[model samples]
Target chain A: MMLRQGALALAALALTAPGMAQDAVRSPDQIVAAAPARDWVTIAPQDLLVMTLAPDAEGNPRKVVIQLIGAPFSQGWVDNIRTLARDHYWDGMAILRVQDNYVAQWGQPDPGMGIAEKPVPEGLKRMSDADYTAGSPNWLTSSTLRATKEPQVIGDWPAPMLTDPYGDYATFREGWPIAGIQQMHIARQWPVHCYGMVGVGRGNPPDTGDGSQLYAVIGHAPRHLDRNLAVVGRVVEGIEHLSSLPRGKGPASYYADPAKRVPILSVRIAADLPESERPHLQYLSTESESFARYADARANRRDPFFVASAGGADICNIPVPIRAVAAE
Target chain B: MMLRQGALALAALALTAPGMAQDAVRSPDQIVAAAPARDWVTIAPQDLLVMTLAPDAEGNPRKVVIQLIGAPFSQGWVDNIRTLARDHYWDGMAILRVQDNYVAQWGQPDPGMGIAEKPVPEGLKRMSDADYTAGSPNWLTSSTLRATKEPQVIGDWPAPMLTDPYGDYATFREGWPIAGIQQMHIARQWPVHCYGMVGVGRGNPPDTGDGSQLYAVIGHAPRHLDRNLAVVGRVVEGIEHLSSLPRGKGPASYYADPAKRVPILSVRIAADLPESERPHLQYLSTESESFARYADARANRRDPFFVASAGGADICNIPVPIRAVAAE
Candidate 1:
């Protein structure tokens, strides 16, 4: 038995050798490397958020790029956030909380800390708890939406898709994992709280969120927050900056000392920035064949180093691939 | 229709109000707080690993407490590691790797860097690849074992259990989750790789691991490594010391600069330390009713703040609870 196991292991290793003729199973890396340019979708400048932070110790400004969820999904919140950036509402605001294995949030220390109170903008309505889900009437218009009652097979294993009894099926759409339920003939969807996904912060009442305060999940997927909180978007680049910050010390891991807070130098919409300063970011379209292959490869990795495939993958496990195009 | 949606949202919130008559689901925090003393298992000093690092910039020594997976599972690796610690083989050895969203590993830069290589100890035999599993003949001796093919119900939802067509069903055993398959009347089980779980790093071919190099999973649960690597234990406390380190720059995130490497002050078995210096640590027993309740609460949280429970939870979502005991 021992000899047989050893021989099997050796045979597996040989399949990965450079000169071997047999083609090994395509790993996620291999699948991604072979993808065509057309399989990638460029981010619309109007949907991009560029947040610049106070200089690091070495005097280099730290920047985080966020890609907002498209129309019919938290569009009101996204528009409000973009307006806030245009008005410089987030300038000088500090990242006040960095709870370990949770989130990093930033906003004014007080609601009116640095800016004067102003009338609520037109079309920027207070999002109620009902608006926090895809089941809402506003999200029923997307034609590409679909619902699944069973786990989707990716690669050779069943993907870790969940059928929530309380809501619509949780699945992926357009490179973003969304949770939604079907009402009548339409499917309503909201973005999930996966790592690096950004959400709007609020007080006791659900409708208080107005895009003034925002947070990004920095650790494990806090999926319970879905349908409860407004997940406005996801960080496309520079998540390491947010995740690597020193953990706060106060309740909910708020920075106890004022000096430790990381400050926001400026916040700008990609379209509003000078062409030279704007980032040319692109993401793997969920509809692309390469994406399907990539998702399957990730769900059941067949890399040489891995002895056994997990045969399953959770929604959070599949991070959408993004890359920055060099400015011409 | 909008009004009805609003009414339903309001009704959901009402269920969580303090005065509601229905028994609110017990949260994981509540279950843990209400646990009886018998539900807690004291750690044997001999099985405790105390790793002390050079003082941080603030002049306080960085200490990490690790709890070894008990007998018959990776015992050979454990014994060899303990012997290495006793010989001070790790003293001055640097933490060479800190891969972002992955692992932090530490040991000598090369074999025999700080200490001379010696003959393998009498009891510390080379563990074969087959020993990396619970289904092996050696692990079949444990009596407190059980196997399940169905998803375990944790709280109101089914736990995210995987049925690996290639190997065994992945589920929990004691507080530790395991991958096991039943043969005839007996079940075979082995420890799983979850966040904060420690593993023995080795070279090509499985038998080469002698426990000299060790790493802790500091990011996503790499379940694909299940039967591939030898996982010896987990970090019970001070994981922030490992997770918060600066990521290395070299391939696989190895520290490229020697000056940036964090140095190990000492590695000692708790039993070898003075009684006053030993950690008074205990973990919630997997066999305890409190543990079951805690697992359920984690899977489908009923906390007042959570608006909707994720009807399922992956293995990495359920962290084994541990606490330090006050000196008698």
Candidate 2:
């Protein structure tokens, strides 16, 4: 709650200075609380995946909600996943692996025996190596547009930033953390593999992922997976349900006994559900001025609890704030 | 199991090269399995903290094992902690906090109410800010001695390495990850705050910590706490028991309901226990050549599962392998 309060205060500041003379630096909670309603973007129901897990022996069904990244950002993977979910592809699928401090993956028990790959839907594109990079002119144009606006400053460091050799720049676009390399005219960007970020699991071949098997990061951000995996989106709500799963004990943290697996009840697009049953979720808009301050505060916490500021923050360490809107 | 296999293969490699042509790299399991008995250091019983947690509703007691760092490495804090446990100071203390993606702290519900501070034991010293740095000539001498040993090579990078701006070098001494600066004729080092690393929680004053409240990093490594906190040791075994606890929902992740708190059944020093009851444990020695290779392999994984090796690894990502020794 202190962190939440801090997050709100930070989100409220429009221009955060490293050591500016002020009564006190606003916390992220205060900043977010002071944000205008327009600064909160409602997640489209169609882009939301509501996964209801079968009740355990105790009879409590676990529900997890995911907010898919919008179009042109892992669009192919997202579309393919949405198609698979809509077709009831994962209704009976089980959470196969829950590696401690790693990932919790859900898919068919035997990949080859169950859930044969289906033809790629008409409009959904097959993801490839090129999909990993945002080298297209469109991304550069957007980055340029973002640069025209105020650049976020964390401590004394300005962002769209870079922690090089690791990545060229760490920036945000459409509410996703992007690690990018800026060349002469084009920028190559890809979604970072932060904790709670969801990705499609596949075999040795990069293109083999069809979204039938997916995993959510449950540990320290495995940034090496960046560009190597198709991170479709992030777990916006009910991440606790996913993170709290019993860690699997077999190879790659697969459940040794089939009976130990947690069964998936169903995964439905929020839009397909009745209006009354749909989740009204809103995320702090990355494009908003408030978010810039929020990100900075997270990078360099100036709170009383912190003795020294980290001076810089890793891309994965910064969590995007999300909340479910109350039903009218 | 696959990760273990990979670790084994990586560990078995006699000498790791960044991108050198080799038949294959050894996994940690293999390296450890093939190690000489002498390579495996039996944990001194005196330094082992055996924590028996109160039984769950089903009456299943959860046990956690912590191996305290040896003398001269948070010696004062560790000594204080040992004395407290010896006095049965935390017999009925409840685990007051279980912060999701942060830490699980166990101590008195009210800092001032339950366990009053005890007088310092005759031989145990109180820790201060000076203990935070390895600036002492003894440390510099040892660091100088360590510098003489061949530095570990991971890919093209060398260790005692530095992640930059954060620290001058990332090295290990006595099985603990250390972030240090190799200055002229002296080195300033401190144990890094990596996952599963245990630390003493204290008040606002830097010197206030006396090991009454202790916590383990349960999620991402909060590296900012490196020098600021007194890191006593690491959770050597049964960490899953700690990591899987129900997260508290109150401010700072404290359990909202007092009933929800898990009680500490008892804490015993292994050395004080009957010989038959003492835990049989061994840890891979950090000083060995095998560890150099192990550390390097972890930094740049050559496993088949990983397509691209993170050219460099952060200090936190490298986990020191530990195991329960087979009973004689």
Candidate 3:
């Protein structure tokens, strides 16, 4: 049993092999592959965090790349994360918890484990719960915010807005998935919790996390966490390293045995790495024509394997495609 | 870093431990634990599929339990699955593909593997593509189907309907999450592809799978497959065994090295096992008041950890609670 990618395009093109379809009506992967280099947006090195974990059981190196969210959303926590990375604060930390169908969190081990808590670096921002969401930036014009129906035209591009149950509307902005609502002639938007989205883990009321502790969504998108926690960024690559980790047996999936923790070797900002060691990556611009077609194709599958197309897709279903920059 | 379940109720009750909340405004987990025995419905052994995989590298037993969908949805494929299980057709099969953020499929190995395909047992039903969906059952009344807004009342009970992007409406019916639409005064509905939901896998068009091949959703809800493939059941337990398996490197995440495939020891219907070996499981009835409150709590988290509650939840986010029946 197989759900081969680009099956529809292959059949339509009468090709025996996968990924050979070149026509206009192509698979999502094909569309992304055919996207012009001009449509790719290179992520800034300062915005990238390279986390190196201890070798797996087979002694294979494991690295997870996280792209920090830019301005207009959770910048306070994002900045704190950068500070922590720069300070090497998480160097000796370990993955402490992995909840099934939930999250895999890493930070200081629980005090119950008899481990001393490491002090966080100075110069971290103190963010309030209100910082969880932001006033819709200028890019989200008033007209777009006021549109009552979906497929609203945002800026110069006609974004394929989704009908969401979590918010008034769900759409993409600045290469990120966001949900928003119009309130008193103002728009309030927040980065959503899609699979692989990174978030700050905090204690109870009045304590928005300081970013010393972080977690990645490893299962279904836990939308309930949106607006409840500060979404800092998303894992751009190597999520399998965390998602496949053995789940903790303790409450909330915390590792009950201190010895079982997977050690974090180091966390470094891409800019801090040597010039020759930096990893170059780019994402399909959300505003590009290729992305529009890709989003539409995700919602409506014209591939041969599909007997019926889902007329629409949820925000998390249309993940932005990211890839390593090809060597020039 | 933690998302402690029932945090709100614990704080409200001034309890220092989890699961101590007795009040109505408790967490979703608390609500399920407090549900009365009558609100829990036992799943018949005949409908349970016990799949035993080879011991893990650590020699740990790995068993996955699946609950088959009952009447009014994919019953033809469901029956075929039962026949295969009774005939031990998949005893020696191996898990073939595990695509990240997609599915884990197992069936006959690729012809390129040089392994002979086992002929399917006789008397297996040949289902058509039309069986991918079914006419709304008698239980789904016309009034419920025609509701134009959220939280429609079905029968005497009010089901918390969700605003869905893929269908006209999404809600729970007979303890299963479903999406449906009303057309020409007739209702058509099908099971959804939520994480852990199992489905029959087929090749290209007109060859609707005969249940010889099967796959399980291991990531986010791949709703695009809804009405395109046949959803037969869900993994009620031990999904981590599959979700944590090493992802394949071959195209479509098929294991390129045939030696890497995890062997399936056996598949058996719980009813076919010895009486003492049968698993006793129960699920919170979707029609019960406890479920109504749980669903509401899921959509709106009054939990102390949450600063802003999501006003609503998608169908997949509100998974039906299933647990083993304690020995009396």
TM-scores, all candidates, are 0.81, 0.81, 0.90
DockQ of each candidate relative to the true complex: 0.22, 0.20, 0.37
lDDT of 3 at A103: 93
What is each predicted model's overall lDDT from 0 to 1? Answer: 0.68, 0.68, 0.79
Interface RMSD of 1: 8.1
Q: Compared with the true structure, what per-residue lDDT tens digits does model 1 show for residues B147-266?
A: 121124322212224323223344455557666644555555678777889999887677878888899987666666777788889988777788777778776788776666888989
Model 2: per-residue lDDT, tens digit, A1-328?
A: 1121222243332345444333157666767777788888889999899999887556866788998987566788888888887788788778888887888898645454344544444554568856765563333322232121112443322333423223434667778787665555555677888789999898877887877789998887777687778888889887777777777777788888677688888999999999997989998887776777676666556666656554445566667778889865
Encode model 3's per-residue lDDT on B75-149: one tens digit a residue.
Answer: 999999999999999999989998877888887665676568898889988888788788875454433333222
Candidate 3 lDDT over residue span A278-303, tens digit each:
77889988877777778767876776
Which model is ahead, 2 or 3, in terms of lDDT?
A: 3
Model 2 misplaced regions, further than 4 Å:
A1-25, A36-38, A55-61, A111-126, A136-165, A181-187, B1-39, B55-61, B111-126, B136-160, B181-187
Q: Which candidate leads in TM-score?
A: 3
Q: Could you say which candidate leads in lDDT?
A: 3
Across residues B226-310, which tens digit of lDDT does each residue of candidate 2 receive?
6678889889887777777777877788887777788898988999988888889988777665666665565465666565554
Q: Which 10-residue window of candidate 3 chain B scores lowest in summed lDDT?
A: B1-10
Highest-DockQ candidate:
3
Superpose all Cα atoms of candidate 3 onto the true structure and report the RMSD in Å to 1 decimal: 7.7
Q: Alpha carbon lDDT of residue B64, candidate 3?
A: 90
